[model samples]
Target: MLNTYAIMMVLTLIVITIVISLVTRKFNSSTANFYLAGRKVGMLTNSTAICGDYFSAASFLGVAAAVYASGVDGMWYAIGFGAAFVPVVLFLASPLRKFGEYTIPDFLFARFGRSHVARIIGVVMVQLICIFYLAPQMVGAGNTWNVLVGVGFLGMSPYQTGVVAVVIIMMFYVAVGGMKGTTLNQMIQFWVLFTAMFIVFALILINGIGSYASERVPLVNPATMTVEKLMAGEEGSRPYDQAQAVMSPEAFAEVEAAVQQGDPAASVNVVLPQTNKLHPERTMTFQEPGHRYDWLNQFSMVLALVLGTMGLPHIMNRYYTNPSGKSARLTTLWVLGFIGFFYIMSSVAGMGGRKYVSELSGSDPAIADLTVDGLLLKSDQIMPVLGKLLFGEFGLGYVAAGAFAAMFSTVGGLLIASAASWGHDIYENYVNPKAPEWKKVLVGKIAVVVMGLFSLLVGIGIPAIGLDKAYPSLIAMMVTWAFAISGGAFVPMLLCSIWWKRTTRNGAIAGMLVGGGGSILFIGLNILKETGVFPAGSFGAALGSLAFPSIFIIPLSFAVIVLVSLFGRQGQPPYVNSIWARIHGTDALSERVRLAMQEAESRGRA
Candidate 1:
């Protein structure tokens, strides 16, 4: 009964979001406004909008759930996601804006002579990111629906209905609103997301969450029934096959002593000389298990975050919305500050949710304890579920409203960005050079419909995609695919276009092809064949052994770009003084930026 209010609240929020998006179309009706918010968005407003778009289902729900599930390893997701922006600030943002291309491909095409190659790279990368991104958000929407509204359509469950509604709503706004409307919606949605998250987390402190003693998740495998399995393995069996055998003399002696003394616990816990981390490798269980890391995991995660941000097309495109390179940089600084605060709050909220939610501990324990329905559930479902648990139906409703807004705002940005890739970068720029203004607009609108439908299709299967009950881990992997492909493929092109005047057209093409193709093939043939789509034998298993979306790809990409660039002799960057003047600037930038943008708008192909 109470759930109806929660559902209503979310639907209301979705309606509000659509109305707001439709209204923002007033800024400017040209391609620029539709594609880049007319390139005149204020630093503060734009920064907030970026946060709305940047903090996907993963950031909001994934991080907290991870921490709740894993000891120290789970936090890595947040670190990597947040810190990745540092690279964006240092190398990509301002220059990207100044280059003034609508999409990543547009920049590549204009900067290099190979428009076709750029178009191909742009399409592949965008398609991958969009799929990875769209699926999880749909999954999250399903979870939200089940919790807030009850699952019962043709026995279709609330989760399925939520996925349908959310995707439809996302497609609706993206098709109707375009870029200008999307940005405005994003800015508003981010604030609501932050505020709702804050209220729920703050309530946690009042209820005493942070100060609660931290404890390890109870180790138990009801299947097969044994304390050995319960404490250290799976299905009531020992996790290791001696798996505890000490190879070194020093380690062997220690193990022998512990075993002789009949101290199995000590024997299990004993450290081997060559081994790192007191805990040996085991299936990392977070949200039921996987994607685990150590305390420094945050540092590694942050490394990915800062470095990866240098390449994300959606985030990078925001810079171009500003009038000048200077405005672009300033906008990033603003984003960092806003995002930082929100992230800190996210951590607090997660910790709080962990303490308060009993059902998350699999409230129905007699059910065999094998499934999430048996003993506590995955952590990603913790946030929205907790809001309902603690805040009553009304509180759940508020959080759901925020969630709906977050989903719509982000989809709007993605749709607009996708539309631009098709409209400006590929169709208008290459296929139909003579394509008229109305044609470009029509093309963009059509692309939105196509992409939106595809996203809906992807969302349907996401429920079955995860390795465990906590679906966010899969969602995180999906989002990282976009980041990795972008960071690995586009960052080189983006930076080289701006800084290295000597980068040749041939070098750019090589880097794009090699980097993009290598990553795709590696993921498809080796990784995704098992994890994403199909299971493999030993060879495929070996490919799946490595941590995904990791730094492994970074070196290969950068090496290819530099090696290829050095081999060639063309496209050298401009002189230092000229480039410096273009990049650096001063305070009170709004006026100067606006004036510069107006001049560019006045002169452009429009």
Candidate 2:
């Protein structure tokens, strides 16, 4: 049955979107107004909007799921996500806004003496990053819908229902409201999500009514009819003791069915319920690191997330919506504060989930009913599962609303970013340079529809290919791939162009080709190996780490760019002094505007 409260929250979201659309409708007539909201977004609103766009399902659900499943190592994602802003504030935020471009391609082309090569490269990279990122958002939306509604519409599967519904709704808002409506919606959604998350954390962690990772869980030996403490998995090995702890007979049969169908991860490790390795007398705590990530994995994951934030097109484009460079800097500072608090809540949610599933489920008959044959079959479903267990349908409704917020806000920003890349950067520049403003806006709307449909298709198909098993884990992995690609392909070149005077167009192109191409290739190989296209062995294990390629690909990109620039005879980009002065100077808004205009006019002459 559909939850009435969930339906009401979703309807409320629709109504708010409609009101914002009506209010912002007048601002959509011009390409400039449509894309950047007339560059009038304030610091607090912009920061909240950015958080709405940045958090996504990955941060909201995936981080919590990671912590629930893996314990202390899961906190690494929260740490990396929060720390990502440090570089954004110190290096990119103000300079990027001062540079003043509609898109990443726009900035790169203007910075590199209006090189068409740079613009085309930027469009390609932006499309790659946005498209890859878009798929996971769609998948997460579908996952949320399954939990919220628990039923399909018009014979469509639950996953398909989610993908179609969210895509169509977001496409309408993005197309009609453009950036103005999307920005306002994002700001509103951020608060809704933040409030929902805080409530869950307060109830679960502060109340101490829920189980924590550090607490000992009770497990029953089906054969012996005896109860014992359940131990946590330690570093360097899987806990066979847990596998040996059998579920109900129905669950045991299901495990056997899964193993028979080629799912080794689900296969049981013992013939009977066992507890020797579990140390039934002791309790396990999640106070240490290295539960899932080794030192190398930790370094690579952190590097990708940090460097990747700089290159993400959807995020970089937000700076352009700021009225001035100073506004952009302030926005970044606020974003840092918001993101830190949000991640703390995410950690709490994860711990709460761990506590709920492990320690609390067996104590209460009502809570026990929420489990699948006495165990959490899929860890990714931890949040929704907990919602129903702890607070019934009302809690599920609130969580569903928050999940929708996470999905819709990020998807809205991404579609706009994709539309701008295709319509303004590619079509306006290459296909119809003389197109009028109205025609350009029309093209942007069309691009939004096209991109939304494409992502929706990918989201629906992901489950058929067996990639949707662990709800948030698969989503997180795909998102990390997008991050890795962005970090390798764009971060090195972008940072060099802004900070180093020696960066040449040729060098940037070389770096993008090597870094971007290599990252994609590595991801493809990793996918192939994962899907059993490559036999299991050393080669497959090596390909495993390649899935997170920033550690290696980023360094390689830096080297390629530096080496190519050193050998190239290209002169310094025109008006380098003025560009640097504008980037680093602390001038009044009007003075900054004058300098920006002068720089643009110089680029026009060149």
Candidate 3:
């Protein structure tokens, strides 16, 4: 349908992944290597890997799409991603690494002497988040493929087929490579993503500089309400005349009847129904004829990003792979700098989408072109769509490569984390205590394949149920639930173990129950129907839209854990010396941090 660049880019990306994963096979042969790189990663590499993992299909596509669709207010997700890292840096990173556990539950079990509850919760959250994440990625893959190839399956679009293919590929890498494979692959993938972004920016600027079509702009002269002149004389659009302005006051006011109608364009149909209630500008047009800014709430939007990043499981697990607490902290800073730079590039491409394409290509094309099209490219496709428009073959190829790299990188991380939770946290500790190291690795590898297949099924099912449009949006919401639950349920215990010393085992369990359970339960009930469970409706239907139930659940969870811990006699955590070494080990990891990020790691670690 489009061109070969898209297909070629994807093929090259897949080939590289296979090559790299196969090479890293040595590292993945052992259970420890597959799961956590044998706990010996350097700061810079670890941090870069973390950023690669942290930035999911959502960051690559969703955030920019949100900004394009909703305007400046859409930056909340990025802000949340950055904000979530602060707590990790300030509190969690060091103690987590020092605890010397394979997963979060392992720490809970080691500290509290009852690992079952934490193990169950860890597995549950990992499974849920991974599935939520995997579905959108699969949909993204399919959508990309559909655009590159023909919609192939007996009337089913080619895009859907791509999703299945991508998932299968992901299963292969994840099952074979484990954490070692994933880490190396992700590091390389991030670089590809960055390079593709650069190409996209360059191509857009090339077209924009000598834009032969700038003259076709729909200029709105707020003062005269007439055709301000097309950009250097475009051919198609008709000049705004008095007669036309009077009828559609929203877009254009009629010059002839407007004297009688009295600025009739003020109450145009395009404006939202309740625009007057919020702002002084009573004009109801969707695009304020002459103005550039869109009305948006910045406060809560940033709040989400701040909180969401901390809860992200893939990023969190990266800290545990470091050799020392200081290394984990240093890696986080590197991730921040790395991720932020790309965000700047992403925004530039988003603007390019608005300028070059003039329409969103989310699920359909030709519906709304140009301004609305940017909104249509499901959150992940925003950058790629813009690339296709500006660079044509070369640009499209670059973007396809970047997108796959991002997708694979994210999935690879998630699979490893999931494996770590199930294989290391549950299987080794509880299911088969006597299992050998090699055997555990085998089981973990098997778990990756099983989990991946399950993820694929869920991804395909989302579209079948007609909620494909909502997948990206749902992932962000689910992440919030993850963050709120983790922050509320576990943060208190983690803090107590390191600083409070009075936190008791009983309190940790109660808090986990109250915080984790409460948030999960609330989030679960809130999405009951939208998940495609028996198409019901009415006034009661409004309840499901109250989707982010975690808003309420998070605070409740924190309060429960703190109170429970306080009620029981706080006892000192057993791993205090090791935790202290990790949490405050500037000297211990000076050598490790020096290894990867010799210069940059020094200040942040200190």
What lDDT does each candidate get?
0.62, 0.77, 0.60
- Tens-digit per-residue lDDT, 1-606, candidate 1: 236676677667777778976786465367787788778888888888888888877666666665554524555566667666666777777766765667777666555544566567767776666666676677667766665565556657666778778777877776667777777778878887888788777887677764323543332211111223224645333333232432335433544454466544442332111212324564322222233443333343445555666766667777778777677778888878876776666666665654565434344232112122122244566666667667766777787777777677677777777777777777886789787776777788888888887877777766555433323245565565566566656666667667766666667766666656655555554345444454546666656544443355556666677777788755543333333333333423433543564466468747
RMSD of each candidate relative to the true structure: 8.5, 5.7, 10.1
Q: Supply the global lDDT for candidate 1.
A: 0.62
Candidate 3 lDDT, 56-137, residue by residue in tens: 6666765656444433334555566655677777877876776566776666665553446655765676566566567667
Native-referenced Cα lDDT, model 3: 0.60
TM-score of each: 0.80, 0.87, 0.77
Per-residue lDDT over 1-606 for candidate 2, one digit per residue giving the tens place of the 0 to 100 score: 377888899879978987897788789888888888988899999999999999898887788877765566677778888899899999999888877779999887777767888889888989899888988888778777776776789999877898999999999999999999999999998988888787787778655735455554432221111121112246323233444444556555644454456544332422232232223443333545554455666788889888888999989999999988888989999999999999998888877786576555676454454354444544455666566556777877787788888888999999999999999899898899889989999999999999999998888888876665423266667887888889988999889988988888899988888888888988887777665567768676567645577788999999999999999947357667766765566646434754666667779768
Best by the TM-score measure: 2
Model 2 ranges off by over 4 Å: 209-242, 246-288, 358-375, 470-472, 538-541, 587-606
Model 2 TM-score, all chains together: 0.87
By lDDT: ranked, best first:
2, 1, 3
Off by over 4 Å in 3: 153-156, 202-301, 359-380, 469-493, 521-545, 570-606
Q: Which candidate, 1 or 3, has the higher lDDT?
A: 1
- Could you give the candidate ranking by TM-score, starting with the highest? 2, 1, 3
lDDT of 2: 0.77
- Model 3, poorest ten-residue lDDT window? 268-277
* CA shift of 563, model 2, Å: 1.1
